[model samples]
Target: MTGALAVAEKVPEPLSKAKTNIVFATIVLGMLLAALDQTIVSTALPTIVADLGEAGRMAWVVTAYLLAEAVATALAGKLGDLFGRKLIFQLSALIFIVGSMIAGLANGMTLLIIARGIQGFGAGGLMVTAMALIADTIPLRQRGKYQGALGAVFGVTTVIGPTLGGLFTDHASWRWCFYVNVPVAVIMIAMAARTIPRMRAVVKPIIDYAGIGLVAAGVSCLILGLEWGGQEYPWGSPMIIGLFAAAVVLLATFVAVELQAREPMLPMGLFRSRVFTVCSILSFIVGFAMLGSMTYLPAYLQYVNGVSATVSGVRTLPLVVGLFVTSIISGQVVGQTGRYKYFPIVGTLVMALGLYLMSTMGRTTSVWLESLYMLVLGLGLGLTMQVLTIVVQNTVPYAQLGTATSGVAFFRTVGSAFGTAIFGTLYTDQIGPNLTDALMQVRVVSPEVAANPQSLRALPTEVSAPIIDAYADSIDHVFLWVVPVALAGFVVAWFLKEVPLRDSARAGATDVGEGFSMPEPSDRLVYLERAVSDTMRKARAEGPVAPRILADAGSDLSRGEAWALGQVYLHTRIRGAATLDAIAEVHKLPDEVIEPIYDRVIGRGFLTEDAGGLRLTDTGRAEVDRIRASWQRWLGARLDDWDCSDPADRALLDQALANIAAKILDEQAREQEVAHV
Candidate 1:
């Protein structure tokens, strides 16, 4: 174990604080652009269709992007591992810029749809790689705060996207929606090139092209079937039936391929854990409810209530407000209690109740009443969204962290695609017949005026009443149909087993360095108390402990201090010399900064100056052994808790734990080594 730790210590030092921040900022910018674009084009869709004269194919504008994004997300993470994250991220940004430019200048609907698909492909790569970069650059202890901030970014973009789209569509050309992405993409690309680090996977990467192709084909077929059934073709028609059958066969084949592949894109082994399975399902439901509802609600507000695009966007603020408030509160509460299962259960129930309430809305339903319903739904979504991802991260082995994280996201995206398609089908199925009946009753409305929702506003109140009612009823039915889906999610939430969240990065401490040598449990206890104190302070400010506070409880040792001690122990045991200058050089800290820490350790009698260099005392040797034992126990307990039965996995966990313990020590050592300088 000591020999391995010594060899591992030879790796290059981490980036400086300034460089890390720059890289993180670049990642967030890319993520924001990708996330923002997901919904930004929605409000402009009606105007886009009107200008292009393709009302019947308008849904394709969104569907093409979604399908391409789903495929891109599933494959991008592996690509990042095989090549490098910085290169993949840069390529993604460049593709997005090109796609945005093409979409902005597109002369017809077909060209626009193709452009959106291209944009979606790029966006998918950006989203996945942005997340992986954080895991790469940030320390495990600080990850929760940054991850929380990223989640906030998603929420902000989701709320503001429609309003931004509406503003551009109403005041300028709808082309501005795509055009707006160009500048953001250009800036992100510049930052990434300058700051993003080149990180390669430790193990040789094997591309799972067969698995990728099968899954992509399967998802595309399924989405097409859902999108076209009952609208473009009868649900029972051979075309729809064949698509459905093909989806099933393709998906089944994908599962078979993944089971045999060396490095499967999806990694079917993760499903062995109950937590991963449950979280994936819950994530799917959340996406289904969220996008499905978001897609149609604006139409309801505009067509049924006779509002402009801007007003419709403004009216959805109640839901956004509800989402923001609950998300913060839930995070804070979970940080304090470390209890997560309840939030999803309560969230799904509230979501179902909200949907049921929405189903009861009629033409006479007041705006305030509708707003209240939206608030309930938003609150439900907020509570569930943040927690589900945390649980998945908690359960998976650290080595598979990126894959697990992306897997949850992949399921959510797939859910969004299916939700939008199924909801569109339900809305179309109801609205067509309802409109026919409404026109028959209101004879004063001309067929041409009735066909266009924008013209409905000019009609007399008597002529528009039935038409408005028809729109209300169709939307109501859509909500009613979704209630069962939310309810099913509610039931599933009850089955989610709450595992204690670990604070250390999932990849384990070995990746960071080796465990620091400590004299006794009492000495370790002092550091543990400090870690707890620091965590409490951070939690009070940031919200709940969530996953951030797990193994990382506030410790007395700073990251640099830990690193210094670990380096000293490793050098004394194996490489002979343990001078302040040598430690400083290895860690990229100045000798002046590390001098004080060496003085402190010598003062404590852990080291003594000799002709060879600073050497560990007899006490120091015993302390190093204790630290190793402590880390082994800690790692063993975690593996047992996870119910890892495989002997190979247990061995990996042991090595990883040793590395993680060393890392914790290295982090503290480095902190002190650089503190004075």
Candidate 2:
């Protein structure tokens, strides 16, 4: 049959506001749970190591999750396609709860690290599936707005995580760090089951199993080496040497696998685009700066400032405020004007300045001074972080869109892993020697008391003075070393050529989520729809694409006439009937608003309202098909550049185009204006 709504099979029927809210709530919760975990363990890490007695390996508490989450993110999209988005989403939540319980129950560092990994794996699934679910179920007209809100959750979580973690650690126990996820996730799961549609992806995304394993092992080896070197073992030790060697070999192998894989997770081809290349580099450093700082800043607060976990979390607010303020502002500015090349350059440079300022913090630094420094760093991060994803999306080919977007995120996560490990290494290497010298002046400082920030703070001022200085100096050491990394990003940012952002970005498509750098999965079709919508809206290409082709197709119908026919056709095709009432309900407008359109179509003999329901006449059906074919030709003309050498690839691309053509409903006004109401 010549389908009128073939493109809409991928998108579920539009939901009522109540239903949308329910679905949106579930998506936001899933995303919050995942993104929150990325940094939530920060404030709790100090107390966890004190309780577990593996101070040297504390970084793994955060690193294990990041590394595992990175690996899981690579697979989540494909996995969702293979099974079902809702199923994968629920399973991911279950896995996360299980990991959380295990982490909370664990008595040793080894078991805790493994549990965190389990949690990270689950978190990754939650993050990616949440994004895919949005594309799968939400109406295309409203998708960008929701995506942006989800991104805001990520930015808010960066601040919330540390504070919430600290609250649990100070008032309750460090184990509650992971335990907290259980209740929230349980609620999300229940809500998801009820609200999220159970639909499987028609297109089977190629899963790079070997590539996932290779990258997982490679990144793991690399992170483990960074975390372990000069702390658990000497940098030159056989174990450390082997880890780095394995990392090099495995990563090199992973790159080789990507080059050959049918659908590589991080396509080697993406680097050819100057924007992708520079954005990837800057993204890594952004994650490095953001996550790395959040992970350890609590330790500096607790030990150096003699603040409790909860207080330390609050103290970090200046940084969060800076991040939120700039992140939002940058997004708006970029949306108004398509220019964005200057953000990364200025942002990275400011980040370096922030890091340099932070390096000067010591035992004598006041809380207010520390906050100012943190705010500066946050401003720098806010400026640099949000623009990369937007620019890269605009720059990369539509075919490689999904891969490139995910690639930017992958680099950022990996960068976070590296940053945390390096931070831990610097702090660990410095603290021991620095403390040994400082403690030499004190007669008897208990090792246990010295390690526990709370216990050490209980000591007399003079007695705790040396330990505080040691802690302060150690943190300062990390900030000082990391300044160079931020500077490198600044250097790379200069090479990032400004690609004009699509109208979608100007329409606020990427404002919330992309700016804050959410761990979003790639869905090229969804993105393309938004971009096209934005372009049309910006150019005043109002109404439907069908009218533009009607002139060429020689259709007699007016723009509203085409829209009326298209809507009735889609409605009848999907629900087996179309009615004025049904159209009003679906669009959430009144009968009066919809009756005018239906009156014209029925009067024109295109549609008939019978006892059974609304039916499209033969003429109406033919016009719809002709309009669809014209759209197909239009798409084909623009998409011929895609390398579809393989018949299977060609079929997939053709089908996608056809669906897109059909999906472009001959509607009235704009989806944005209607959907918003």
Candidate 3:
């Protein structure tokens, strides 16, 4: 017990200013790299295909990287909790560097795709680990600012990626795209090694191999179905339908497996927390629209507006600017004010409006109008995303920090993948026929060619121009379709309760002093005492005293209560001693509350209280002695129970209990000596 008390006393506070800044730097820089990589490659891909002589296999480059990265992210978080954060982060950096090397060295599409997969794995670690690290080091009060900063960086990266990619692709080789990670990775690794301490390993962790397999399989099937839809097969094709069914089954099994596991990979109990559950729902919706919108914007700009990759990149800047401004300001405000419930409510509404505006784009849409819509989208995202993460981290205990943080990242990534795929399918379903009919009517496509859906992209500009416009228009319709989906996020946000945010120092002190479990209020204890007294008195009644019952009742009463009454009896008797009237005087309690308990005492034969006074018979005295003997034995047993497995806690509780017991024994011995005298 003492050791437990000591451990409770030693809970560490939040990181210092230097550490907080480093953590903030780590999160923002890492997020910038992740978000930038996703957009940067899109602008450079055309150049990549032209140089590598394989436009046919271009989509695989993006697909391969995303698949690999998504798979690695889910596990990296668990690894962080089980092993150590420092090792996982450092290893992720090294892996990214090596992947970067491979990508830079690649001479063909095949080699580059393979290398991209490796890079994805490392990128996955970076994304999840950075988020987890932020939760670990920052206090809730200030975490919003840091999380918001990351969101801002993500926005900046979105705008910069295309421009930077275009610049690199136009002036330098496409290889610089991968090479950019080198210096960033080096800096991140160095800083993290210095700032982040190595976390101790858990005593034992039960790896949910079955759950991992099920979730991986389910996600893979779903992603593959979405990826292949519209492009490869009809939406209702047997293969697609089968894959969807398999996804549902596998995910269901994963949930069931998690429940049965002793130490689950993803704790089922986390779902019970309202904050975690709601935040996860919000994340999924954000992922769906956020990734879907991003995927199509560059394509629309380059394909329909007839702009250069650099210009297309510039066009996306308004959204990023809005996001950056909102995130930074909201973060500081949230940290200072310590309230986060309102951000999500406002953010989801803004996001819905942004999506609605995005759905209205057209071939004839003005550039300024497009920028206005992007700004709305950016503003909405800035408010909700990071704030949701803060709420989750605050609701859970410290030990589950890594797991909880990683889970958020995993859901976000999976949502992004699913969203991108669904929107891709929607765009394809609407565009294919519209493009063919328009080309045919314009007399640019022959009847034979118009009938063949696959040959439309190969047609000349006269045929393809109207067709591309149709594709862009249909794609905008898909974005419109998702407006409701984005709005649905608002429903989740509305349920988010306002929880009190604790500073890291105060949070640590609470963990050591009390615990994550909420303490009962004093008023409730007073009510409980009254209830107990009422229940005990009404339940027991005084009747003809049963000898056996009296004996048992006396055994239940403590020696302290008996001694208190005995002293009162002797004191009152001495005041009227000359008569020796064969009477005992005892403290009398009012009948209204005390009569029932007093009746039980008499019925049990522990004591008889009448007009004369209360008296303890021979059996009552013997029962008291028996009760004391049994109580002593129970006290001895409690010492062992208090000696927990933790040596420090055991030593502390042991010493304290031993000291108290010795004092008790000393008092008993001194009283015996006085009686003998």
Candidate 4:
């Protein structure tokens, strides 16, 4: 953390400005690849099913990717910390490239679903590691601007993904959607290899293997039960019931495991906070409403309204724009005033109203009406989704911040998966009966044409009427069923506690990018570093930092002595010895400029000079340690208001601050990374 560190820490010299730009660009590309893939398949699904011919299994394309991505995101950060962020990032990109190739070539639904799952796993790593790498590489003072830019990428790409997918499906082929990531990923990998520096965690990261496994397995089982119910099996069939039972048992076990786990993947204690608990539920509902609508709207437009894939995507813009605009507005308003209890309360109610309105659509519903319905749903979701993480950040203990933020994201992703699965089950169950009944009444309409929307659309208006009506009814029912879920969220939102926002959290309240939440974990040390940076940013706004810091330290040294001592200590670690000439050369100065400082340092008995250049005396090393301790004390005073009263939590916060202090003091003092090659 920083108090003096704001003006005190040197710019880590490993990266020049050019190198930082190249590294940031590469990270943005990889993150884009991961985020873009999430919604890219939505508009393409109808076309993909037309080619692959397993319409019933269509939702699996979306669900498989989501579940796989969830697991990968949960584990990727720890994996990066344990190994190295750069290597893991490259590996993730490679995995994604390979998965894309397989999906592009797959000849059957089973193979395609498997390939999509692989792609999702890689995408997860790309997203989480890319975010972590920013922490590794970016300077503290500039991290927020960079992080906000990355968040904006998610929002912008989200708005475009469905439309881009539709264009590819219509112009080239549905497979091109997967094929496109390959070349982009290759370029990202190549640039990253040359430009990004290698970095690893300062300490071993804890991975909750059992918790991750149990939750993944349990969620998968639950998804399968919902997906298969009423289609391949009856709701009460042995197989469906078994899946549900296994899900409940596994999830319960996962909860038990997390409760006992040291540094649990999701600390059970976070749910004890009313804000965190309520926000998590609201996040799940927003995800359910948002994704469920995004995934199915294309079907209604393409099948019932007889629009092409590209046009269907274009029509969905209202929803995306509504979401984007409202999220920005809500984030800005909430940031200005620390009050946010009513956003979710109002949001859920609006979401329920929107879904109910959409559920009333028939085959003849006007395009304008459809767009308005979509817009309402989007606005509701946007308002609700953006604030949940911020609220959790404001209320959770400093030690639990990382897990709580990620925990809310986790619930959102899982909710999206569940929503798609449930919506698919509802559609599959209803569509068959409605189609079968229509086939009897309209014998001239063949089953084959009915299965393909493109073929059915070419038929005479009279012949296609009944079939289109059937598709509309099925989609309408899916929305009708989900309205209750949104209403449930409305009931839950009433329980949200409006905690006053922390000053650090309040600083970014107006950031539009903050509304675009992704399932990425925060590093506790990195977050603490940002918090201190915020303090310094405000301090810099007020006046000078160094004088205040010096007054606080009350040490018997001038700024030059401290700067000289720090450089000498750092030089000895890097270059084996710090000669006056080498120090002068490194700073691009003459010996005349450095000689006097060296003589003063030598005269004080803090440095020893000989043929070995210069080395810190034991006394000098202690002085360096003293500066570090001062930094720690300054950091502690600033964080006194942090809610970590439990002795264990307080200890963790202190340890995190100490680590931050050491990092600030040392900056980038890595031994040469031969492994990077």
Writing each residue's lDDT as its tens digit, candidate 2 over 204-226 gives 66788999999899888888888
Off by over 4 Å in 2: 1-8, 536-564, 571-618, 629-658, 664-677
Q: How close is candidate 4 to the true structure, as a TM-score?
A: 0.91
C-alpha TM-score for every candidate:
0.80, 0.89, 0.61, 0.91
Tens-digit lDDT string for candidate 4 (404-472): 888888889888888888888889889899999888888987787888878988988888898888999
Of candidates 2 and 1, the better by lDDT: 2
Model 1 TM-score is 0.80
Cand. 3 Cα-lDDT: 0.60
Candidate 1 residues 1-677, lDDT tens each? 22223223333346667877887889889888888877777677656765775544566677677777877877776677667777889998999998899999999999998999999999888877776676566654555455546656766887888888878887888899999999989988988877776666554456778988999899889988887888889989999999999999999999999999976777898999888998999988988888778777877887788777777777888877877777767766665566789988999999999888988987788999999999999999878876775677567764465467667777887787778777777887887799889999987787567655578888888889999898889889999999999999999999899877544322221111101100010111112222323343344476532122223433344333344456877666446567777776766757776677667767766678877787777865555555556545644553444423566545545665565555554554345445535
Higher-ranked by TM-score: 2 or 4: 4
395-491: candidate 3 lDDT, tens digit per residue: 6543344356556656776676677667766766776677667766687566444332234446676756676577577768877888787778887
Query: Could you tell me the TM-score of candidate 3?
Result: 0.61
Off-target runs (Cα >4 Å) in candidate 1 are 1-16, 267-275, 338-342, 393-405, 436-455, 497-642, 673-677
- List the global CA lDDT of all models: 0.71, 0.80, 0.60, 0.81
Sort all candidates by TM-score, best to worst. 4, 2, 1, 3
